[model samples]
Target chain A: MRFTSESSADGIVTRDFTLDGIPGVLWSPAAGPSRAPLVLMGHGGGNHKHSPAMSGRAALLVRGGGFHVAVIDAPGHGDRPRTAHDEQEIAALYAARAAGRPEGPIVVRYNAHLAEQAVPEHRAVLDALQRLPEIGADGPVGYFGLNMGTAIGVPLVAADPRFTAAVFGLHWPDALAGHARRITVPVQFAMQWDDEHIPREAALALFDAFASKDKTLHANAGRHKELPRFEANDAVPFFVRHLGSAIPGASPALT
Target chain B: MRFTSESSADGIVTRDFTLDGIPGVLWSPAAGPSRAPLVLMGHGGGNHKHSPAMSGRAALLVRGGGFHVAVIDAPGHGDRPRTAHDEQEIAALYAARAAGRPEGPIVVRYNAHLAEQAVPEHRAVLDALQRLPEIGADGPVGYFGLNMGTAIGVPLVAADPRFTAAVFGLHWPDALAGHARRITVPVQFAMQWDDEHIPREAALALFDAFASKDKTLHANAGRHKELPRFEANDAVPFFVRHLGSAIPGASPALT
Candidate 1:
């Protein structure tokens, strides 16, 4: 992992880095200890690693909670070049939608494989993140990802035992169900009641499958894309309670 | 599952059905025994359960090989209604391609979730197919799903032990790798050398991941969409040899 650029603003130090060709960003609180706890944020599908939703949550952790935050684009997403299949599929999906037709098997087939690859890729990123001295090698860690991130994070948290706390949002059940059984970390899962994408029953099924001793389901009234703002409110506190109390919520005095 | 429409042509009985809400089709050779071998043919992404490619294979097995064939649409596809999210994402993907910009994160996130869901959807269709008397409860079974179908087929074949043989085409590595390990059945995997979609290395990785003792890799020269014509020529014989001897390639005598 190589740190390519670093800058500081308003007590937050942000740096962009590359790990084995995967580009990502890290945000740290300036006055925090060199060994502060860290959190990994994941963006939703069709969005980059530092999508506004992901970046906003990272900002909350850095400014409100004095923790280090990290995020990376899943393969063929964000700064990475998408594949020809991907390009064609997306175009077709759009055409179908524009023509008021269903995308059919295209979206599911396209997403499932990427989700499968993203989980291991997230672990690879975690392997590299542990080497950063600013975040401390042995500090407790947390994860927060939704939709595509949830698909990626669920398998990742299940496979890796390092995450002490996690927030999985906007995801539904399938192959990820069995993996949920292996996760023992404290978890906060978010869902939208009127989610245009995910089925309500599937979301409930996924939440029920988590083997975590302590897990909370945060259900809000909105669509899938409208979830991030509502998420940051609960997510900050969820991470603070499990990882540490160093971080504030939106309020500075909360910490 | 409700069999909505049943039709007979050229001594082949083709039935259209909807399992719960998922639309599907079953092709059965009229003269075969009640428990003749059953093979499921899956369609590619952006195509319905009975796309010309899928239907042609079904017709071959039923007429040329004297077997039963089944297929279904992936969620948000086929007769199913596409979601607002699916349309928006596809449109965005197309715009990116049209502008010569990479699709990046959009494709990965969109596909990861869909791929995860499609496998089970395929399984559900399989479950429905088994209940039909035309195929019977305990007949030999094989699978053939390429591209999007391959994505769904890999996981379905891994989870279900009922399959004795399979033909996976137009696929690549990642999620399918681990799933491939559980498949100990006789398998035939196909690819294209100059394919416009899947990466050659990724396809090789998927082929290598299979734990099957008998597996053959067929690499031809063509684009992604042109695979069905080449595949039908070989896959028909493969299923016949492994599952049972009933299919004769494109012979008027058999039909």
Candidate 2:
């Protein structure tokens, strides 16, 4: 998708817009009159559009590959109002649920319910992307999500089938597997061995379930926060293989 | 040296001052109503107050140890003006003095001159610190410099013996040794294995020249940019031992 060339001298432009009726911030690089492929990115839980992880990746893609990227605040993050009580109250609620609980069915049920409530907000963001003028209809479109974003994005891509390629970093297998069978586009999955939230087995299983014509999985060396920068070095090739023509200086390997 | 409790929250205040009569920015964190320990921090080449490497260390000291910290601009860097036309001009001028083959003699002469020009700026900052009412007469003072800061600070600290402790990260041994023997305060030296600027042997020789009754050396696992944060985690204890009480919950091994 081609972005308009009105970005600041630093090649970045910041704007506020409504996506599926949810207000959020968008950051895109200046691409002049030329059209560039668009990559829709989602941040991890409790992170906002200006999150270091998201902004860092945006910088790499903009400077390293000249791709137009956009990131939106997820529900209850950034400017979004918290639908629940204050942070302390929420922490206490979660603490109580974990107190004396075994690590099995009960915890799984509670998490599943939370995940269900979050899906619609994520879908809204994806749907809103379809309406943005900056995102051209004729070019390749990619989606990238990490952790919580991955949870929402995998299912959204599975249910919608419009994305040309998708990459999920440090995510769970069960949630991803359910949607993986439905993805027809190229998919890249990164599994972090030291992740605190997701198990390695589940990550591997999700990678195994992807029935996409082209799929790649990388077992990385750091914790979740360090994975994005690590994957950026690996992602250039993946993007070039599937969306090479749409991105400037796209290469088969990270230089 | 006890600073007033109120002053620590207000930050260190400075009087109007000039370096070579050139206006400069000066700042100090209010250590407290009672006298508290102080640290003089020097930024790396091409770096200033807001540089991530410098600011991150300041944050750690303030948040992790509650120490008062001060940082200053050096000659030809940040707010400081170049004595020569430009970097290339300066290099060329030095090159000509060394018979068009600028080698060790040329570099030593060039940096030594730069160090001379920077002394007054460093002193002006120290003068401002001494005038702070909150910093009382008894609180200990320390000095730490990173990269180029070490080049200038080693001479600055050695020539003036008021500091109670000093630390250098990424330093040139032969150049620094001129002042290293004069440092009576407890000293700490940290070096990165892969430092591109200061070779390992030079750093080691510099560390060995210190005649302080108490000395410590830390060989870290990363490059120059990563060394500060890693050393900051350990340097606090060194400061606590020679300066005052350890920061609460800080490990004793840090010293």
Candidate 3:
């Protein structure tokens, strides 16, 4: 489940690759051929390759922290096409949820439908990482997610134990409440102090319930978008300590 | 021609008016009507209300510094159409100047074109400011600019001399080389140490050439985009000192 990447101290090079016939983007710093650690970054809802948060983080990792970063679009996001449920159907689904019309089978079906659309794309990105020439067979890998990515990425880490560390920002407990026991890797949870969307207490409890050997909680003074500043400074060091040496291309010094 | 504007410590119910016509966006802590000292903000190139730099500066002014900030777009930029020459024609004009073609008539024509297209809109914004009921006749006013705004704002300050103080980031000396004598108000010139578009030495020379009775030069450690971090701590204090008390609706206490 773990993968290696290659990078250098100056700047990272982003190369396009196809995974399981699905196109994806890979990032690594410009360095002599050398194995380096990798961090898999997942974007938030309705985001794609050019999302500011993801691109900013990737730039920070390459220039500030000197880490190799990879990013991909999720299903029904980015350039992907809409599923059987277009905007109207999706609105109806949410309306149904809001109106307290409990259709258990329908909820399950919708969840499965989303997963069916997304999991393949996720696997494609992961599989492409394994096939990268520079990543090698034994390099360390980490996962970082924001919002919806937290929901999708946690299960990916659980299914594959090779992910040595993870960081989740602005995540609620219910997204992965039942799967906490499955995540054995070191994890860090970053939350906003006054987030309107996610209840702060519930988010803390979810991080606390995780059965990882090592877990840490962090908070920022600002709301959801501003949380990245704390991560820019804190998360890089945590990844370096847990995942391995700073990835040559992943260091912040380059930025 | 120095103008002053004052509001309560809460920064609501501003008192100074210089230009007339534009309505200020008002916010107060209390439910009732209030006013504060006005902070006039000018945006850079090709930006409008949705611009991140303008919005970020406005947010920082409101949240970090506790000030009432107003941002307006300039002419031929942001919600304004280009009624004049396209890029090729503009390039030809520059080429004509470089080739020492007839300069006086071309300069006059160019200025006339801009005056017709850009100046009226800017004057309209200023005119709007002159009519705010909360702003006093002699209340303090602070002006700040970035990039192209810096280019245009210098002439405005020179001609009007109403701004109590101002901050200019990323200025071009060639554009304002002749107007230094007109700038008698206290001013701060912030130049990036590593700005690629504008050389640091030239910026310093421009600041030195200014005729302000009181002025300070701040050297930030970042490029043009990162200048906000330098202002993160000092901007509020500088504005408060020059622009009088904070407004009631957008006070620092909210942060």
Error of 1 at B76 (Å): 56
Please estimate how well model 2 matches the true structure, expressed as its whole-model Cα lDDT. 0.62
**Model 1 agreement with the true structure over B116-185: per-residue lDDT tens digits:** 8777777777777778776676778999987767777887888888898998867666657888988889
Number of the candidate with higher TM-score, 1 or 2: 1
Weakest lDDT window of 10 consecutive positions for candidate 2 chain B:
B1-10
Runs of candidate 3 exceeding 4 Å displacement: A1-10, A86-117, A222-228, A246-255, B1-255
* lDDT by residue (tens digit), candidate 2, B1-255: 222222222333432335344333333443433555677788776677556666656655554455667776666776666764448656765566566453434444556666787777777667766777645555777887866778887898888767888877576766779788887677777776455555656766787677775565555434555562435644555566677642456533222
| Worst ten in a row by lDDT for model 1 chain A | A246-255
Standalone chain B TM-score for every prediction: 0.88, 0.76, 0.71
Candidate order (lDDT): 1, 2, 3
The C-alpha stretches of model 1 lying farther than 4 A from their native spots are: A99-108, A247-255, B1-255
DockQ of 3: 0.01
lDDT of 1: 0.73
lDDT top scorer: 1
